[model samples]
Target: MKNSSAADSVVLGPRPQYPIESVDNALRILLLLGERSELRLTEVAEYLGVASSTAHRLLAMLHYRGFIRQDRRSKAYVPGTALTGVAFSILQQFDVRQTLRPFLEELRDETGETVHVATLDGTTVRFIDAIESPRAVRVASRLGRSMPANCTSTGKAMLASLSTERLHQLYPEEELPGLTEHSIRSRAALEREIAGIRRRGYATSSEESEEGVSSVSVAFPAEHSALRLSFNTAMPVSRVKRADIKRIAELMRSTVDRAAALLH
Candidate 1:
């Protein structure tokens, strides 16, 4: 049988071209590696919910690209030097972590609470930097921790900047996870809250992401032209009283403007 030419093989509506599975697995692998310095193939497979053979194939590809390497002693896989190089490059140039560390530190000094900078990655927000509070009873949120966007002030602040089209594209009217009683579950309610954030120029979550914890966030403009940088402050509700929201919001606004100017 004669094979069809390449031009004749073009039949589709919108086509899916990117390696979605591999990319998802890659991200999952990176997340797992960030949590632990190393992982076994079985553990990786279990984490990704893929067959051992499939996991091996993905791991082999990553190994080839120097994203993951096999240890000589433990025979376990870990992030490679090349990945570190890529991460450094990203941090030096574009990652939110590097861009906002100084600002976060300043904010921490000003507020005396844990200050964080976070950005949206899919439906979750990734904490890029954190400055710990000096007090004994402090709320510790570390860098690289991914939390639900719908239940976080930083996440909401970024989400508020999105257009309705973009919001729909990012989160469909489907099974939105609810972490606590304060979690936004309905599309209408979420839309309203996001609109409020846009109007108010900040976001607040009252024990939505965690019990007895309150967070305030303001999004800063970044060079990406699409992405938004969020400044997050997590403190006890008792500490940051209702009377203090205005002052905190003012500080966030000033710091974010300065950070944005620095980036530009």
Candidate 2:
């Protein structure tokens, strides 16, 4: 009779019967690689409770399939281009509208104004989602519309989050185009406004993008990778008084913080 070692006697509790053992082991390796930046064969073998030779064979298969690559210097496994494509594809399937609409709706309801989620597009800000105010006299919904990033509250908020070098790259010229007289004209002027936004933790546009609309916006923290986004509440200048901007800005900040938490 052969004597069993502690390793051989150790039992893993119940697992699904339908999964193929080899495929399951390979997937487990893939998941482990996803969590870690790099993995050595010895580490993989220890992690999976398998022989070094078995782990090497699994890694070789993954490398051949383009899901993993070996570092020439370290001989450790890292995610490959194929894995990046898989991750991007999975991210593309995430519905931003579905995830953010409830927050926009809640903001609109609370503020009694139009709420917008805008993302930067070149020198412009595109409105990706909106919830219109219930009041008949509210600012018109700008969903599907694009406006200059230098002029809109949401745009300025996102712009303020960018680095100075990036800002210069985006606006090489001295002057930026304006939709209204209120719109920022010079890069220097825009920079100053952005400085204020950074200090205040939010931005405001007083008829800058449109004749009658005024808005207050706050940029989402830099953690969101899918888009550089901001949340704004727009109202007719008649409805949103000067004193109201402070209250609305605070509300926008709180709502954006909650939305950012949900995203993570």
Model 2 TM-score (2 dp):
0.65
- Candidate 2 lDDT over 198-257, as tens digits, reads 999999999999998999999998765445788999999888777799998998888888
Q: List the residue pairs that clash in candidate 2.
A: none
lDDT per residue, candidate 1, 1-39, as tens digits?
222233233335564576587776776676666555467
What would the TM-scores of all predictions be?
A: 0.64, 0.65
- Which structure among the candidates has the greatest TM-score? 2
User: Which residue pairs collide in model 1, if any?
Assistant: none
- Among all windows of 10 consecutive residues in model 2, the one with the lowest summed lDDT is 1-10
